[model samples]
Target: MNPPPINVQPLDTGTTFRSQAYHALKQAISQMDIYDHNDEIRLEERQLSELLGVSRTPIREALTLLEQEGFIRLQPRRGIFVIRKTKAEIVEMIQVWAALESMAGRMVATQATDEDIRTLWDLFRNFEMRNPKEHVNEYSDANIAFHKSIIRLSGSKLIQEMTDNLFIHIRAIRKLTIGQDNRAERSINDHKEIIKALERRDVDQAEHLIRDHTLGLAAHVEKHCDFLE
Candidate 1:
């Protein structure tokens, strides 16, 4: 199959090309469905150079940075490919995310204003009685957005930055798994409960609910899914 398109804009002349290329490539990789079994995604230097209107040198430097950050793999013979975490690796990521996001939830409960908490209600307002099975893709996006909102609402720059790489995996996993079994329906209910806890400013309950919600995916992957197999 053809490699995925390098979705980058032409670089501005002011900033260094290597830095711009790194961020652009990282963002593009993060947005891709890198786990699709049928699509063996690869990155090409010439293609990225053309897309970014720069030479291959900066692209190479940028790719090396991304490789070090665990976003892509620099293979000797097979070419550059996006990194897909193994099952155990993904579970570990979810555990780490659970810890960070749960603390974010605690902060949000204690610090976010009523208006800030109310914003979460909008994410799933339209999906109230609808069948998530029929709209799994859309709901999956909303679900991911809701979790991101939690991190943002926490008002912790460190937490947000820490989860940056984690989202590259977490977003993919959530999208892939949300429609499985009866997880989508249960997910909605869980979100409602979490929101209520946040609204009531119940720090412990909010933290517990958020942590358990994230950790549940780790457990599911451990016992149920063949995602990494």
Candidate 2:
């Protein structure tokens, strides 16, 4: 099926053309079904220009940023391709993600307000409603939400910014891991325990649980790297 065309808005206030272009392209990648299994999805500069309603200049700039951030590859004599990491690289990145998220959990344990906790509980409720075994996409969304909620609650802007960058790079690995054998169920249970720890405001427990849960993806990806296929 042809992906629906994206309607790019005028640059948001206080943002540069490159920034808006980057955000628009990122949204298109995540929101559209543009990939084919076993084959790299190639995007043309003109197609992106037409879809985003921007000139090729900003498109080139945006693609450059995406390339630098490990999202898309600009191949010479080829085309822009979504980049997938090797199994070992994915495992290493997940470990790095775990360390950052664990620190976020520790910070959020003390900094999160009652409203923040309530929002997290809502995400848990959404996860509970989905059949993890069959609804991998839904489960993945919930899983991302549960962890990202902690990062959002952390008061350190630097931590938030760093994790946001890391999150985008490893999002594919995370989605793939969620599709592994019984992985969604395991992730749901881990979220439950982490939530409980957060509810009790146990900083140590929350940090430890979050770290273990995040690292758990590394194990899953190591065992089932082919899940990405």
Candidate 3:
């Protein structure tokens, strides 16, 4: 199925304000800037509004959206707090991600244009060449771009949206993985193989490569990372 065209609009004043506020709040929450000293940290709207230089309305709106996505929780009078993932929850999310990515790769193998393949190959090459010591952020950004490009090529808006939402929850775990020695190198190699499979229009190979690569990353997190504990 083809994705509906994305409508890009000129930024109006209200759209700009809400977008700025959403980004500011999202960064703070994702980066763990807000903390609660009593057991778990709750997101305080007043503090966020003051810190982000926005009003409570937009802050509340953003919190509501995040809460709906399972990124955060809102307790009646207790405040909003980030939802920490359990080991089982993390594993389940990883399984779902693997399935989605494999499906995406299969679709891309059949549907991707030459331009799509070229752009993805360039991004993968750039990711491979990044020096971990000096360009970790660049490498991470490129890695995300490459995967997002594949998802775009799948031509499914609903799947793309769900995959993006999962990424939001997995972003912290991914940061932890990025710090490991040889992890980035292995990831680049896996991406290269997947790109080759796509280039050949080998749907079976592409699906297998994508699923295995994602499951390998999940295994690393389950074995070496304490995020689930």
CA lDDT, candidate 1, residue 27 = 84
Q: Which model, 2 or 3, shows the larger lDDT?
A: 2
Q: Model 2 reaches what TM-score against the true structure?
A: 0.85
- Winning model by lDDT: 1
What is candidate 2's CA lDDT for residue 5?
A: 49
Q: After superposition, how far is residue 37 of candidate 3 from its true place, in Å?
A: 14
Collision pairs in model 3: 36-41, 43-80
How does residue 100 of candidate 3 score in lDDT? 94
Q: Please, what are the lDDT tens digits per residue for candidate 1 over residues 1-229?
A: 5545656788886899999999888888877766656466788788899999999999999999998988988989889988888888999999999999999999999999999999999999879778777899999999999999999999999999999989888888898889888999999999999999999999999999999999999998888767586
Write model 2 residue lDDT over 1-229, tens digit each, in one string: 4533444555554657677889888766654333224555677889777766667898899999989877789989988886755667768888988998899998888888867776777776765666786888887777777777787888878877777666754665676567778888888888888878887899999999999988878887777665454
- TM-score of candidate 3 against the unseen true structure: 0.78
How far out, in Å, is residue 1 in model 3? 47
Show where candidate 3 strays beyond 4 Å. 1-42, 51-54, 127-135
TM-scores for all candidates: the values are: 0.94, 0.85, 0.78
Per-residue lDDT tens digits for candidate 3, residues 30-111, read 5541211224655667766666666688768777777777778999977776777776677678889889989999999998
lDDT scores for all predictions? 0.90, 0.75, 0.71
